[model samples]
Target: MILCCGEALVDMIPVDLPAGGKAYAPHAGGAVFNTAIALGRLGVETGMVSGVSTDTFGRMLASQLEENGVSTAYLARSGRLTTLALVHIENGGATYSFYDENSAGRSLTFADMPALGDEVSALYFGGISLVAEPAADAYASLLAKERANRVVMIDPNIRPGFISAEHTYRDRLDRMIGQSDIIKVSDEDLDWLIEGEETIEIKAAAMRGRGPAIVVVTKGAEGATAFFGDASVGVAAPVTHVVDTVGAGDTFNAGFLAGLNDKGCLSKDALGSVSDDVIHHALSLGATVAAVTVSRAGANPPWASEINR
Candidate 1:
């Protein structure tokens, strides 16, 4: 089982009403939550670990996870309001206006953690949950506790607005990234992490030096590359019709992990010595899965039956 640790919230997407005005439609979202949903849909045994509300949106999130075959037994329930992101779409890209003050997902603490079973083989971490308050620290602590024998993956999925302080957030992020066995970062995040690394290879190596066994860099339309030691493998993005680019990264993360899982590469020992062929396959799988999401309106990932995985 793979345990995804982060925020679970509702995304309020703008939509046209038949009556002539536009309104917001609630959808289950949040980077880590989306990854968990996609993994479950991809036929991976997965579970979500986070703080969620008992509110309408929270209930919806829980239902979506279960419906997608993601376990919600690790959820920390509260009476607090749910975090909401008002999505603004323009030219097929999406932006968010968050309403997370004092929300359930942002209020998680170390005490809320659940005991992990030996069935768990790997763990994934990322998203706004890493920028949110006490929850960020809580998630970090959980990672430190369970990363000893488990393979760990992380995608910063950085949202600049959520970061309250640059230095502190970077420090926290670096700590987590250094502990991760594999990490996927957007080109934008790469630039932000290292200002002097002229080439992607240099930046990837710099990140790999920080501790991760494998470092993957994703360029929006260009593609993604994975670096390990002195070797690197890459794949191009699949051509697909335009739709709102909401959950592309999350879906890609799930697909990549799923591909690795299929190859029995979810163990720390396997990842430490992963081959180029394995990396290439995982990258291709991720891009293909993300292509399916790009063809849809929301952050909807494809099921295993759809891809015949």
Candidate 2:
């Protein structure tokens, strides 16, 4: 099973009302949550670890996960209010205004973390949970505990606005990256991490040197590339009508991991020795999944049947 650890929250998406004004519609979201849902929908054995409220919105989030076949056994239940992200769409792009203060997802501590069993093969980590206070520290601690036992995949999915302190968040993220087997980052994230001191490729190489056997750089619309050692392979994005790119990156992460898992290349040794063909296949799967997500209204990912078709 692949375990995803991070925040689970509700997104208040802007929607047109029947009357005249627009209102926010609640949708189950959060980077890690979306990835877990996508992985489950793709027929991957998946589970989630996070603090979820007993509130209505939290129930909605839990129901979405269960409906998609994601295990909820690791969810830490709490009476704290659910985190909410108000999404504003302009020109097909979405921006968020978060209300996460003292929310359930952000309230998790080291004590709230669960013990992992042998059934878990790979662990996925990223999103705002990497930056959020107590939860961030909790996740970092969990990563340290489990890094030696499982294959680790991380995507920073950086949101500059959410970061309270640049130095601290960077230090924490750098430490997590060192413990990861595979790391995925967007072009924007790369630029920010490396501060444009050198070329993107050079920066990626530096990141690979840190620890990750495979480093993937995603260029939205253009394509994505995976780097291992001195070899790299790039795959073009699949063609699809644009609706919204809410969950495209998260879905891509799930697809990439799912493909690797299917090929039995999810371990440190296997990933380190992975071939160009295998890398290409994973990137293709990721692009395919992202295409389905971008063609949807929200963060809705396709099921296994859709992918098989």
Candidate 3:
């Protein structure tokens, strides 16, 4: 079983008018939530640990997760407003301007972390959950408790502009990084984490020394690369007639975790010694899922059959 712990929110995507303008269309989103839903849709055992809201939008988000087969036994609904991301789509890609701060997700506490049964193999986390206060501290604590049994994966999915430049968000993030076993970072995410530092080897080595045994750097269009210990493997992105890249990376994480679980190698140390064939299989799965996601309008990923094909 894989447990995803983070925010479950709504993305208000822009729909272009025939007259050449835009409007907001609400869709369920949040990096960890998307990954959990995708994994559940693929027939994998999955659960989500996060806070929801009592509002209608939050209800819709929770319903979507349940419909996709994600277990929400650990979900907490509060009176606070649900987080929102006003996503803008243009030129076949989407960019987000978030409206998150003191939202329900940010109000989480360490007591909210669900007990991972012996069946739970990995813990996945990402997005702005690492940026807020009580929730950030709470998630970091979750990583500590799960460090011995389950693999911990983190995708920063950084929103630099949303965070205060004055505060040391980076330093706080580094603590979580040190607790993770795997870290998936996009080119844009890396740039946001540390400007002008594009050296994969250097970044991977530095991050590995901190904690993560494996580091994956995703390059849009160009594909992605994975670093395990001192070795690295690169995989080119699969061809696709692009639509929108709303949940591509999140789905990619789901695919990778799915592949790892299928191989009976869900532990952090095991991932570092994966063979070339296994790495190729994992990367292919990730690319396939990402391709399916990019073809959709919002954060919706294709069914398992589409990924298999």
Q: Which stretches of candidate 2 lie over 4 Å from their true place?
A: none
- TM-score versus the correct structure, for each prediction: 0.98, 0.98, 0.93
Per-residue alpha-carbon lDDT of candidate 3 for residues 1-309, written as tens digits (9 for 90 to 100): 799999888898877788997888888998888999999988889989998898998899889888999988878878889999888777987777878777889899998666767877889989888878788888888888787778898998887766774256787778888878888999777666655655766766766788887788889899988887557888899898888888999999998888778887788668767776676677778888898889877778767876563
What is the per-residue lDDT of model 1 for residues 1-309, given as tens digits with 9 covering 90 to 100?
Answer: 999999899999999999998999999999999999999999999999999999988899999999999999999999999999999999999889899999999999999989999989999999999996799999899999998989999998988887888787899999999889999999998998888749998888889989999998989889899999668999999888968789999999999999999899999889878999899889988998999999999999999988846
**Higher-TM-score candidate among 2 and 3?**
2
Clashing pairs in 1: none
Q: Worst 10-residue stretch by lDDT in candidate 2?
A: 192-201
Worst 10 residues of 3 by lDDT: 160-169
Give the Cα RMSD of candidate 1: 1.0
RMSD of each: 1.0, 1.0, 1.9
Error of 1 at 272 (Å): 1.3
**Clashing residue pairs for model 3:** none
TM-score, cand. 2: 0.98
Q: What is the C-alpha lDDT of each candidate?
A: 0.92, 0.93, 0.83
Predict model 1's lDDT versus the native: 0.92
* TM-score for predicted model 3 compared with the true structure: 0.93
Task: Compose the digit string of candidate 2's lDDT tens values, residues 107-126.
Answer: 99999999888899999999
